[model samples]
Target: MKLISWNVNGLRAVVKKDFAEIFKELDADVFSIQETKLQEGQIDLELAGYHQYFFYAQKKGYSGTAVFTKQEPISFKQGLDIEEFDDEGRTITLEFPDFYLINSYTPNSQPKLKRIDYRMRYDDALRAYMLKLSADKPVVLCGDLNVAHEEIDLKNPKSNHKNPGFSDQERNKFTELLDSGFIDSFRSLHPDEAKYSWWSYRFNARKNNAGWRIDYFVVSQNGKDLISNADILNDVYGSDHCPIELDLDIKGE
Candidate 1:
């Protein structure tokens, strides 16, 4: 199965770009999106041969997520069920016959670590949530997790040590998550590679390849062997973030 996860920054904005063409080009079996930045009754996307599931934030034009899949899931859940977190529409869990596919848009810890506390709480909650789901079946969690996990994850990790995504607090949480029986798909496949999925728009960052590997395809340890390939599609562009792809040996079901 071919899976894709991208932080479009804004669904409406990227639509103005060549989103349609890119979507068609990738042709993912399951295409997960983050930071949709839309409300109900917003722009309607006509993606043929796909089932669309959207979870919009309570606040209009804010954080949101969506999934377009060629295979219809047995069932789908829209939120984490935590009142505060659910308000932002951060996650969507789709239950297939074999596993649970979760699409998420993690909350960012703003500059100066202003929201670090809340971000930490969110990390813990999401960790517990994934663990719970893993107990039943393997879970495939994909999206912009909003953290540059290790020193190698970002271009200049030394300078960004205390920054939001590269902060020690966030990085440790990621380690904890992996210890709790999850595998960072990309890292598992390409151990020494330093590819990135998100780049800052300023200072010609993309041109210089100064970016952060924030987006991810995290799979439960129980399902690690299913992953065939994990990659960062740096050449594709629409938002500040590029799309990450994961191929699994999972048969069509």
Candidate 2:
């Protein structure tokens, strides 16, 4: 099975940038998108062959996520049970026959670290949610997690240490998530690959290859053996963030 995740930044903007063509070309069995920044009746996307699921934030034109899958899931969940955290519409969980696929657009620690405390709380709640789902079956967690996990994850980790996404606290939360029972699929497959999935739109960062590997596809330990390949499609264009792909062999599992 093939699954792909991307933070399109904005759904409407990317649609005008040939997102439909890219989607057709990739033909992933399941494609998840984050940061859609749209609400109901805003834009109509004609993804013919895929079943679409969207979770929109209470706030208009803000954080949101969507999932398009060729194989319809057995069940779908919008958010964690916590009402406070669910307001942002950051998560969508799909329960397939084999596993749970979670598409998330993690909250960013905003300018001046103003939202750091809230972001940390989000991390705790999200981790607990994933763990609970994992107890039932393996979980495939994917999307823009908004954090550069380690020095190897960004081109200039030293300078970014104090930055919102690269702060020690955020990175450590990611580390703890992996240590709990998940495998960062791309890192497991390409241990030394330095290419990134996201680049700052400022200062010609993308052109200079100054980027951060903030997007990810993480699977529970039980699903690790089924991972066949993981790839970062840095060459693909339209958004500041690129798509990350994961292939799994689930026939035997």
Per-prediction tally of clashes: 0, 0
lDDT of 1: 0.94
Task: Give the per-residue Cα lDDT of candidate 2 at 46.
Answer: 91
Tell me which residue pairs clash in candidate 2. none
Backbone-clash count (model 1) = 0
lDDT of 1 by residue, 1-253 (tens): 9999999999999999999999999999999999999998898999999999999999989999999999999999999899889999999999988889999899999999999998888889999999999999999999999999988899998888889999889999999999999999999989999999999999999999999999999999989878899999999999999999999898752
lDDT of 2 by residue, 24-122 (tens): 999999999999999998988898989999999999989999999999999999988777668889999999988899998998999888999989988
lDDT of 1 at 2: 92
The best candidate in terms of TM-score: 1
User: What alpha-carbon RMSD in Å does predicted model 2 have with respect to the real structure?
Assistant: 1.2
TM-scores, in order shown?
A: 0.98, 0.98
